[model samples]
Target: MSLRNITEHTIALKDFQVQGDAIKTHPLSIGASTNRTVNGQQNPVIHIRPGETQLWRLANIGANIYYKLHLPGTRFHVIAQDGVPVGRAYAEDTLLIPAAARFDVLVQGGAPGTTRLETLPYNTGPAGNQFPRADLATVVTSGTPVTRAALPTDLGPYENLSHATIADRKIVVFTENKAGTIFYINGRTYDSSRTDFVSTLGTVEEWTVRNDSDEDHSFHLHTNHFQLMSTNGKAHDPTHGVYDTVNVPKRGAIVVRIHFRDFTGRTVYHCHILNHEDMGMMAVLDIVPPGARPRATHSG
Candidate 1:
């Protein structure tokens, strides 16, 4: 019961909206307004002071939707991810925010119930190709709204297992074929592997993602960032702190953990919506620095 690192007042998400998109029935907008903006907008509530430790700075200013923030019973710790700050941290019931990213969660607010902030669209596809994009729930109580009835069907529980010993791991494979695409992370579409993983510097990678098509694809990566020890298989308390876009909970299999030191060149980990990464999804990485093996670009 000794968790100190308290910093108060920090919860800002000004006007965000994104209501469901299949053909429109609940596709509110304004997660940053769109042009192609990758679906973003679910629940955005703020208010803390039950035990202190609230320091949030989330702003996906672009909207690509795929957040799974929680606080129901309270168990938070995700030091930093798109904002940097993690020497070796863990813990995540659900934390992923892509699209111009930005995260810094650490809620330890003691008992008081009500704490839900959901957003879905991991990689919507299958189910006959798509249709059923409707998930936007938000509740950060202090007064009203905290009556548990629905919103915890499953997919919640990864409090750190053992930091899956890593030497090197990367496999992000998400697909969505046809023509009118909307999601696809690893299947070679977005400008051809955008930058196709290339780490080395101080290597310490781990990304075992496989959302096999049928919707739910939020595999984001940019400038080598990781800290989501586990999900799907369970485990999230290695200090559940440090994240960068981890909402891959449908087919489920999220394992993020990196330490490539200060970025290198070409940094962009797509699938944040914007026309499904310009109609193909996206991928690109090159933090090279070990046994250099560059030169592997494809296009056919």
Candidate 2:
């Protein structure tokens, strides 16, 4: 995407740049960059057999873009989220992807033709950043059909935290400062000396996160994946599965249950928006074993 905007416009062949003095506030354009050369247009091609079922791994690896993927001729059987397999597959025509999120999907190829992987425009809010829609990539199917089987419904040996007793509890609130420029989590910013919350290893914790800000924000943790228990005071479908990161709607709340298992270290949770994190919407999380005691407590 061309954020190196207006000042560099004359250098490029096409008028692919957004025209404005508010370069920092304008939406970004899309472009595909590779190891050798950066293509202002998407020239990447994916080949597939007409009748084969392919596993498509979709990731919003971009730092700021939110891609809502749409494939007109295909249906995505979402099998995983953030590399963790879901309990069951979900069939959807479009999938919303925030920054730092991922989805593993199974797709049965349609008739021999080209399919465009496109991103529709998304409005986070008047206060949140808005990104223009753009085509991400293209997939072409050729050759004769191949034998295909139905999507497997089973995701093996996944932990069910719903039945687990909650050993700890926390409420994370996201809000903005009075000047409306910076973001705050739990009324504070990132301070390594100040850990926001400490979770013990081998325990289950239920957390409620509320977004008091005017813009949409996403909550992402480093180590453990969490299950969505509720959103805005309603329980989500059990089959919706787990996520490593989740979108916290403006002025709304989300409840998730997490199991700290087999790992003990310091990690962090922050808004996936890169600028937001740099602006103090991040905090440290220390996970210690049940008996260990050698660190600071949550100050925020």
Candidate 3:
């Protein structure tokens, strides 16, 4: 299942301005798709036998919205995130997914009845928009009851970067103008001609990402995944696994350690919110070969 925002009238991101950290046009509706139908138009259903388990891949593919998904009387056994398998499956009653995030979960069918998978109201912050509750899909279990399947064990191993030798550390800050028309990272707008950060391949580096603005920002990096070390000065369970995107709360900070593995090239790190990205909350990163000097470019 994927969730997205739908406006009453189509509006381009370039034309949609921000005021006080809120968009000029709030989404008229939040659309959910099991396959093709939107807003449960056809009442899309997931048919399963009672007590049987099925794997469900849920994703937040929207540009700027967040989904706090909930299925009453059901617990989601999360096994993976962003397509990467976790160290072990963990149960969650609600999932708070920001834009571009994905969660793969195992769901066991309940009694022979129908239930709605819905998103609960989520308030990003004082400066952000409040998203209301919306139903995403209908899950129907009608077949004869079956033996409950056991949740999977032996999920692949995950790397823990807590004690890794960090080659370097960087600080990334998210900020925005008072009017909220423009956004920034590290105090500057994105300049395509400039390279903001450079790192050597095969090195592990830690980054402290701070959100200075009044709203939340989903920090996302390209080319490699990162292990979240801590958020708001609180340590995170390394066993939760790595992710390509994470939420940076308003005026709070998160520390992530990343291993610059195999691929070497230029990529970007930015706010996953498309509007903020389009408004300039992004930076360029270049991974050069070890012992090689980085190419000259305008500094951000």
Candidate 4:
């Protein structure tokens, strides 16, 4: 199910030019594709046979805001993340989904009853907006029961970067002005003509990304996915797989390892919050062929 947040107020052309903080206060109407109702309206329902397992491909395609999804009394057997199959499946009662992230999971129908698929209250940070709880859809299991399908123990092999030799290491810092009107990476607003980072193809590099602002930022990269190594000095499980977008906590840091393979060209790394990107929390990244000299001057 694709999830998105719609604005309750009329979106004007000037809205697109607003700063990130100003955009945060806009009223949101969050809903799923199958059932797009808002504000106390009856939610669309899905009927399932009890004990039957179904694979649900969920994607958060919204531009801003986060979804802390919960389906009480059931667990989601997550098999994939961001469309990439994980090394192994894991179960969780609540799934914290950021914008642009996707997860494929196996959900088994519970006893005959109606339950609401809802998002819990999520407070990003003191400088961020607080999203209230809302129901996305309803799941009703009332048909004849069926045998439950066995969950997969393993999905497939994933890139394990634990023992790989790192070619280089870089640091990225996220910051913003006190007014939150303009955002920056490494203290510079995004300049399309400027190449902020340059790397070589066929190389693995580690990056330590720090967020110095008071709000959370979702860091996203183009071209290549990255495996999270640690968050705030805490190591992550190798099986967590790779993702193109990950959250960087306010005033905290995260470590990620990226393998620049195959493709080489100019792309970008940015804060996934749409308004933040519009306001300047982005930088250019150019990946050149191995042994090829970089064409443009870079900040780092």
Among residues 3 or more apart in sequence or in different chains, the pairs in candidate 4 whose N, CA or C atoms overlap within 3 Å are none
Give TM-scores for every candidate, taking all chains together and pairing residue i with residue i: 0.31, 0.82, 0.86, 0.86
Which 10-residue window of candidate 2 scores lowest in summed lDDT? 6-15
Ranked by lDDT, top first:
3, 4, 2, 1
Off by over 4 Å in 4: 1-42, 298-300
**lDDT per residue, candidate 1, 86-181, as tens digits?**
544445666555445566656555555565544433334343222222323343435432322111112234333244446677888766764344
**Which digits, one per residue and each the tens of the lDDT, describe model 4 over residues 1-300?**
221221111101011112354533343322212222323234556666788777777677667777787888889888888778889889999988777777787778889999987888888788777777877778898888877777786878889998899999999999999877789999899998889888999999999999999988999998899999999999988786588889889999999999999898899999988778878999999999989888756443
Query: In model 1, what lDDT does residue 179 have?
Result: 39
Error of 1 at 127 (Å): 30
Clashes of each: 31, 0, 0, 0
Per-residue alpha-carbon lDDT of model 3 for 1-300, expressed as tens digits? 211221121101111234466654553222222122223233356676788777777777667787787888899888888879988778999988888888888777788899987778877777677767766667788888877777875587889999999999999999999877789999999998899999999999999999999988899999899999999999987878599999999999999999999888889999998878988999999999999898899864
Q: Where does candidate 1 stray beyond 4 Å?
A: 1-63, 66-219, 226-268, 278-281, 286-292
Candidate 2 matches the true fold with a TM-score of 0.82
Q: What would the TM-score be for candidate 4 when compared with the true structure?
A: 0.86
Tell me the tens digit of each residue's lDDT in model 2 across 22-93. 323334322222111013344366677777777777776656556677877888888888888887778988
Global fold similarity of model 1 (TM-score): 0.31
Rate residue 135 of model 1 by lDDT.
29
